[model samples]
Target: MEFLQPTSWTDALAAKAASPEAVPICGGTDLMVELNFDARRPAALLDLTKVADLAQWDIDDGSVRLGAGVSYARIITELSARLPGLAMAARTVGSPQIRNRGTVGGNLGTASPAGDAHPPLLAAAATVEAASVRGTRLIGIDEFFTGVKRNALAADELIAAVRIPLPVGPEQFSKIGTRNAMVIAVAAFAVALQPARKLVRTGIGSAAPTPRRAPAAEQFLAGALAEHDLWESRAELPGPLLDRFGDLVTAAAAPIDDVRGTAAYRLHALGVMARRTLAWAWRQYQSASPEGS
Candidate 1:
């Protein structure tokens, strides 16, 4: 096997466009596991860590642009203020070592449905920028994942960056696993409220073939908020609304029984996670107000 180290994005793009079958590695968190398990053996490896551009990030014009190779640790430490939902999800990722090495690119590149990053990214309505020798294109989070362990990225394309509109309000992420840290999610969920847009978006993971949004639930919540004027005047969220929202989120998942968990349990957990995450986000919003503070 051959190894190619790219010093720049252009170099990586050129290499990828030329050798589309080469395995692209930034941190090797997921790819190495496949390699160690004899599940994958590529003819070549395109190492992307040397490309500095892929590890840098910036915030501008109401959006956060995260370089593909930016580590989960950076996301938690450097970007938590700007992207709290993603940061919270990042904290729930593997161990400290894994967090320092594992990146957003690898998380999306593997495209595992249970990946913790997806739900937050989905809730944030992120867009993935991809480039190749051919050209560049932006793929929305909703359309990015085609199926389990699958994505819309072309073989010749490399993920350049991921852009997400800055959070305008409260957000939170939750996941249930067999154990606390370093464990894969049995069921995970993310909820974000965009006050400016009056949008309430929820993303469900592990309980589906791919991380997916609960559009109906989001619409329902958004409508409710609109009716109540987003509880702007110290009004609390009604318990009935919370229950309905949880039910709607549970209805969005399509899980199957597996060694990690059962379909019934996953559905139950999705409901609980949805309710808890929503409550947490709402608490954050309430705390942000002077009266509540």
Candidate 2:
């Protein structure tokens, strides 16, 4: 296959716009696997790693803009202070070697429901920024994932960056995999306690056609927290409320039996994960440290 490396995003977009069929590659952690398995063979590739702009990041005004080429390693080390949930999810992505190359943007390019980064981004209420010859557009996380292995990105558009507002309180992520490292999740979940808004955001992965937020669970928790004034206190979430939160999260899932896990088991695991992550995040919220200390 012919490889075309562009030094800048403008050049890269022009190249992709000219050859919309050319596979756009950044880290190649995902694309290379498909190529090696003979699942795909594009005539050409648009390699964006050489573009300096796509590898840079900016943090300002309680928001972070991560470039498409920002690897899992960078997110874990540099962004952990600002995006603890994403950093925690990044830690579980793959091995050290895989993390060095694999990127959140690569996950966006593939749009796999099993991707570890998806749930955290969704829980953060992040935005995916995409650009093409036509121009740039920002898509909300809820609208980004349309179906299994699909996203809102168009054929000629490339992922430019992801924008996330800083978590106001504590956030957490959890997953159940057959094996911990380097294994796809049987079911994974992320929860972010937004104290400023008195909102709870939950993202369910692997057990859905697309990674999605558990809106019912979020609404339920929000009402309970507001009633109890838990957002400002050290009090624990009530047992009954926690149980119902897990049930609501489980109800939002539509899983299929696969080699990794059964649909029934996946639903059960989602409930457990949702409960655990919410408890952990609440504990973090109670901590004196605003940085989840």
Candidate 3:
């Protein structure tokens, strides 16, 4: 296979426009495995590691423009304060070596239902920045995933960056895996509480065809909080409310029986994760300063 390395963003865009079939590889954490297994053989591999622009991140307005090539390790060390939910998920992605090499962009490109990054991104309402010689367009995270191992990216497009709003409150993520490290999740969940907006958002992974938001659960919890002025009170969440939220989260999943787990187990695990993460996030919210210090 041919390997193309471009050092600049413009050069990379031009190369991609010229060879749309050239699979882009930044971290290569996933692509390398597919290549080694001979599961995928493309005519060309576009090496993006040299493109410095894809590894830099900056906050713009109220959101962060997270470069597509930024490593999970960097997210943990550099961006945790701004993106706690994503950082939490990044911590659970593979081993230390993998965390140093794997990227959120690679996870997006792979579009796996089990991808650890997807849940937090979905929960945070992130956006994907897709670019080409034509131009760049922002894709809503909710609409980015198309199917199992599929995404909405065009053939000639490359992910430039992801934009996620700065957290207005607490966030949490968790997953059930066979082992603590280097194992795919049987089920994963993330929750983000936006008290300023009086909203609660949830993301479920490894329990659906695509990483997805628990809209029913979100709406249910948000409405409950609003009804009780819980957003302002910062009172303890009732057990029944948490249980109902978990049930709604379970209802939102559409999983299938796979070698990793049964559909029933995934649903059960999702409910548990949803309750636990929401509780964890709410506790953090409760303990925070009045001004969110």
Which candidate has the highest lDDT of all? 3
Model 3, TM vs. native: 0.99
Evaluated at residue 221, the lDDT of candidate 2 is 94
lDDT of each: 0.91, 0.91, 0.95
In model 1, where is the ten-residue run with the lowest total lDDT?
284-293
* lDDT by residue (tens digit), candidate 2, 198-272: 888988899989999999999999999988877767598889988999999999999999999999999999999
Residue 194, candidate 3: Cα error in Å is 0.5
Q: Model 3, 129-151: lDDT tens per residue?
A: 99999999999999999999999
TM-score to native of every candidate shown:
0.97, 0.97, 0.99
Say which prediction, candidate 1 or candidate 3, comes out ahead on lDDT: 3
For residue 139, what is the lDDT in candidate 2? 96
Give model 3's clash tally. Answer: 0
Candidate 2 CA-lDDT value? 0.91
Which residue pairs show backbone clashes in model 3?
none
